[model samples]
Target: MVKCNTMPEVRSEIDRIDRELVRLLAERQTYIEQAGAIKGERSAVRDEARIEDVVAKVLAEAERAGLSPAIAEPLWRLLIEKSIEHEFTVFDEKKKKIASA
Candidate 1:
């Protein structure tokens, strides 16, 4: 835990954490890409069962981390939605390549 005595320090630490969060999101995206590769259709990109499972896990983790589920749920929902969009793009591009080949 970092203790900050000034606004500049607090802002700087927040910025640093934001950067780390983005990096982790990027890392998670690699697995999402892998999922796209393994899936047979764009429709598979949005798995309601998986979404519920993920949200459950995220909610649990947020509770453990002392974060509000109110915040985590919506944020994770948006992330999942954007990820599905990315997976659809990846799926379509792969389909195009296969068709071309």
Candidate 2:
């Protein structure tokens, strides 16, 4: 048998924070969907400046939180690339509809 140290008092707060994190992620997805709408009017270009700005913000926040900026930068880059792909998909679908009409 293994004995584990546990703090029952703060566990509820941690659980609440986790739920909030999930909620924020869902909200973020909605914004990504809107990003697709925005892309429809813009050029089909992978804006490196946008990506750099996102990376800088993520790294800065991670550093402020006493976390590893190195890991945060790469992780954020991955997320930004995925978001761009999502926006492109939206733009492509909208374009098709416009062409077919």
Candidate 3:
């Protein structure tokens, strides 16, 4: 881990990490869109069972990463909700393309 000696260094490191985080998020979004394309119904976008499964997985990963589950759980829940909305949009657009074809 890189040690920071000043506020500027800390802020710079955080900015760098945030950029990497966004890159990872974009990669995750591609898979979410792929799931939308594979599923037949918009109703499938919100899978409660799968959500719990994901939460459990994230909790475990958080423990491994030394992150607090208290924080990770809520953050992931929001991410999942937003991802579902994005998936729905992708599904609708694809359906429209197919119907028009």
Which candidate number has the best lDDT? 3
Tens-digit lDDT string for candidate 2 (7-100): 7646766787789988986787678877777664747537898889878888888989887977887777887787778778877887788899
Q: Could you give candidate 3's per-residue lDDT for residues 3-87 as a string of tens digits?
A: 9999999999999999999999999999999999999988888899999999999999999999999999999999999999999
State the displacement of the C-alpha of residue 74, model 2, in Å, after optimal TM-score superposition.
1.2
10 residues in a row with least lDDT, candidate 2: 1-10
Give the better candidate number (1 or 3) by lDDT. 3
Q: Model 3: residues >4 Å from true position, as ranges?
A: none
Query: What are the RMSDs of all candidates, in order?
Result: 0.8, 5.2, 0.8
lDDT of each: 0.93, 0.76, 0.96
TM-score of 2: 0.71
Model 1 regions more than 4 Å off: none
Top TM-score prediction, candidate number = 1
Model 1, span 1-101: residue lDDT tens: 69999999999999999999999999999998888888997777888999999999999999999999999999999999999998888888889999999
